[model samples]
Target: MTLRIRRRRFGQIAIATAATTALSGFAQRAFAQRGGPILYGVTLDSTGENLIIQALNLATGNILPINIQRRIEPGERISAFTAISGRFAIATGPRMALPGRRLGRRSRIISSTTEEIPEPQGLDNDAAFESLLNTNDNNLLSIISLNQGTPPFRFANVDRRSGRVNFLSDVDLLPNRRYSNLCQSPRGTTYGTSLGPDTGPVLVQFDFANRSIITGKARILPIAPLSYNKNLLVNDVADLALSPSNQLFALADPTYEGTNSLFIVNTQTGEMTFLRKFAVQKITFTR
Candidate 1:
């Protein structure tokens, strides 16, 4: 079967089986007893024309579609996604736009009232917001840019209530090391994935409050390379998320071949466990 067919079949089987179990009343009770936070993932529909948000039950592995007020267009790409103050904050840009061109790339907080985050000054017109996390204050959101000035990466906080941007310190100048995505736990500990030219992917813990890397140089992920028709290597992480209970999860993508998969990452031991085949681009846990 083709990749699209496999993905459609997977979605169908997951939803149908979950629905059946829910009707039987076992899955719902199990989920409630566990009291785990619902993990949300964003994926394309079967037609690949629109994005669909689904709520995933970690305990039962059941997926249910979620309805949002704002409809994401087909050509728009979600660069960053997260939840704060019981609402969804999404950073998106048009995929068809040319490089160095601004095509209305911005961040939006969706709730009873939709708010747009203003683009900060001194950044290139093409700079895109790549990561978002909630701060201690409900109205302030921590964000990072894909491209900034000299060092190329900047960390800042956005005030959702007043539409103000407060520039924080720039990311540390680590030679040959770059961060791809960022996520924070409910207790305010932030983590990121660091990539380098000579080393494999490492999970770097950060104390964003002080704008420093806590783990000087984290160990490489314990994921082995998959050998298929050719050797397929997992080289990059597309997204990272932390559950309410502080479990680190990653959407790992192969460098050249193979499909994206979700993994449960152990922060202390640098170990990873394959969770499921996730073809989605973004995943976040509901608050």
Candidate 2:
């Protein structure tokens, strides 16, 4: 229902102030809006789970607040609601009691999953649409919305690609309950998550067609034994996700100074590998 996510500081920005923060330890350009039809979205909550969605014309810098009408019902928080072609779908987190705290008030908070936006004029055809949704629990959820320009949900086909680090196909691996955050996998077939109270990256695979996970689960391959010869932080996986290049990275909070860490992973050996990390406050892809 209503779960508190990690907290981050936010700065005020008038329609003209392009929100910009240090990312990947690099000074990413501030949100740019000096061109034509704008293209960009900002979560109402600067950091943490963006509760409110704001659409901005990156080109014109005009911002449109997303007014979602769905309530607390099953699959309320729709994922893939914005797909490319057709056959679309969305999901929901567990519901909470309405303000009245009435009985049986448990329901998802999002529906009409499809949030259709006008395509940027002259946009490339190959560009795929992607969105993330919070699982009822601390889990990762993503959908590939296709040809979002048409009717019926305004999406073509939507499916659950990841459930944490594990792919939805790996449904058998992840625990149905308990966890903090879930992230996308480089391959798009799986997703990873922060360890539960027990502390272990849960990597699972998916079967988007069936809206289910497959295979078993595996702990993120630990830092390479040789990597131990260097340095590695333990105990705080703040956030998890994959970059546009399809590399696995984690936003970890070590017990020492500056726990927020980002890095890619390599599991090509059929095992997880903790690659190097970045020092950015936060990182997002442009796909």
Candidate 3:
């Protein structure tokens, strides 16, 4: 099926021109050699009721939409999703009643009865839970208990089989730390999107398995032209992913007033390469 992503804006075209002149070398080095077949599962909410799940072959840039499933409420978008080994997938939203599901082999929604998971105790009234990433096992889900009144954030795990959420530990970040999205690596290294000071959104890795913070340094992303000269500061990232080649990929959420752009960042030096500008709902890569 054809890709059903949001249309590219003219402002993005201008940014593309500038990116060619400014970031040509970086792009060349990043995409010079293609890796093995990289599969990407993407979720789009353009038509709300029919949440679309598609697979993109990153090596060939081919898109094959698996199916459309009616899962969430009319206005709620899928906040997080994880693709399991057996073609099973689980999704969650901020206002979803049944916040999880198991997808069939062809990405069809399998009929299952699941109830909303209860909030973990000990969280103050001001703190709210947000769905994050799934562990390498896929049975355990990682969540962020964001305390609006405090600095340290609480982490937890949710059992998909029983729909029980258990508190894990607290992550103490810098005072200006703000995460927009979460992604996990095969080695259990969890990456998050952090809005950097004066710069664009960046990636921060937390070794959740080892119960330690790996890195919170700002790996700034590129900004779309529409927001370059305006009062808009930096683009916000909605998703952070680790590519098959150990490279990092980030998706910009247009909800922050900036146009959408997909970025490829080097994991070692923290350099970013502008890939493309499109409104992508969700992105996860597989080798």
| Tens-digit lDDT track of model 1 for 1-287 | 00010032233323323211222133234357555566766666666544555666766565665434345555456767776645556666445455786455443333312444444543445455566665444434444444431125555666665545666543353544555566767776667666666665666666434422554432223233222224333465778888878898888764333667677877765566777776677788754
Write one digit per residue (lDDT tens) for candidate 3, span 158-257: 5554544566434444555455456666555566655545666555555433332445322223223222223332655556677645566766644454
TM-score list, all predictions: 0.68, 0.36, 0.59
The full ranking of all candidates by TM-score, starting with the best, is 1, 3, 2
lDDT of 2 by residue, 187-257 (tens): 44444332344443443333232332333332333222111113433343444445445565544444344
Give the clash count for each candidate. 0, 52, 0
Residue range with the least summed lDDT across 10 consecutive positions in model 1: 1-10
Best candidate, lDDT-wise? Answer: 1
Model 1 misplaced regions, further than 4 Å: 1-35, 46-49, 72-75, 94-123, 139-143, 146-151, 170-176, 209-234, 255-259
Worst 10 residues of 3 by lDDT: 104-113
Candidate 3 has what TM-score? 0.59
Task: List candidate 2 segments past 4 Å from native.
Answer: 1-170, 173-187, 194-197, 202-236, 256-286
Report model 1's TM-score to 2 decimal places: 0.68
The candidate with the higher lDDT, 2 or 3, is 3
Please report, as a residue range, the 10-residue window in candidate 2 with the lowest summed lDDT.
Answer: 149-158
